[model samples]
Target: MTSASFHPTITLPASLCEQAAQHLEQAVQRAVDGAAAPWRAFRRAESSDYTLSVSVVEQAAASLLVLAAESAQSMRPSALRALISVALHLRDAADATRRPTFTTTLW
Candidate 1:
């Protein structure tokens, strides 16, 4: 329950941070313009496009982490670290979803 349990600070290059921000911005625009439906289907229980959803989530998480790193100057170090950790977790979760699973087997 203490702040001491937060993840260690992470460092990212300025160029990468800029790229991440740009990618995130483009993704947002795509969603708003109806050019992307990954997120919408992701929220539905009957969604069949798991691959697209996972890919989008992974990219978004990476972009969030980069943006969080870029905001270090304006935010508390501890809070920023927490945000980065959360983004990392989200990215990992998206990666986990990509693993192959057995849905049916002929016996």
Candidate 2:
């Protein structure tokens, strides 16, 4: 994982985090398996800030997908293990959210 953090100002639903992690992981795996390159799957996009310095909520919600295939192509067994570790960390973090339980009141 890159030092760049995905720290969103607002709490995102666990589902969205999970989906993002899944997409990133799948793309990385495909690249490693020679199915497709990272550049083909990940694209860059630009956004504009309509607000003047009020610190818009949207600014903090940016999702960054960075895949350095140049390095991954030559990754050794240790590197692969590290990659898997990162994926598991992301998955566990996504699942850290608490599930709500509802109780019914008998009339």
Candidate 3:
């Protein structure tokens, strides 16, 4: 095949996108100190001292979505943002509602 006929494209694969998201979440977790820092703390995954606050994992999940917008190679930022939002929301919803379907490993 001619080189011009099959030029490499710039679409971000789902796996790479997920890796970028996981990287961003790790950043937020550090930024939030696993949500246990001073002013940026988020509630723990299992804490009874607080009155049912949002989990740091949850906040990190949300922030990761926003962070995905800046983490991927795509046609537009909106596409990234939407992908992040949808993935996080779906995952979060599934976690909250106990409806997860797909399970996998991450590196």
Candidate 4:
């Protein structure tokens, strides 16, 4: 005899899904804005302040990313993976901005 496997599915209301999607979008936008704030500051900073600005920016971006990821996790499981992928891309872009070859690099 063979055993059958069972998988469970959840059905959320349309309103609930919409609300969740909105929340996720807001969280992601906040993360993006917060991450970019450091870069703006870095641009205005003097050459001697580059190290400090980069350090602060990196920390802020990391914190915002973590918060956004947590928010995504709290929402629909189906969206969590996609949200994480977006976050990873954002982080990669943020890291690239810190490099010497970055187009906006003032140093």
Clashing pairs in 4: none
Question: What TM-score quantifies how close candidate 2 is to the native fold?
Answer: 0.29
- If the candidates were sorted by their lDDT against the true structure, best first, what order would they fall in? 1, 4, 3, 2
On the 0 to 100 scale, the lDDT of residue 73 in model 2 is 66
Candidates in order have lDDT scores of 0.50, 0.36, 0.43, 0.45
Tens-place lDDT digits, model 1, residues 39-67: 34233312332223445556557556666
Q: Residue-wise lDDT of candidate 4 within 1-107, one digit each (tens)? A: 33344222223234323333343345546664454444343333343332333344344446445655667647676666555554454345447665676387577
Candidate 1 vs 4: which has more lDDT = 1
**Ten consecutive residues with minimal summed lDDT in candidate 3?**
37-46
**Model 3 TM-score (2 dp):** 0.29
Each prediction's TM-score against the native?
A: 0.43, 0.29, 0.29, 0.33
Please, what are the lDDT tens digits per residue for candidate 3 over residues 4-98? 56532122234434443454445565463332221133222113232222243354455555445445764377756655664565345435644
Candidate 2 lDDT over 3-94, as tens digits, reads 46533222433443344344455555645443133222222111121111111111111211223333456668676555445444443433
Best by TM-score: 1
Model 4 alpha-carbon drift over 4 Å, by segment? 1-24, 28-64, 102-107
Q: Pick the candidate with the highest lDDT.
A: 1
What lDDT score goes with residue 23 in model 1?
Answer: 40
**Backbone clashes in model 1, listed as residue pairs:** none
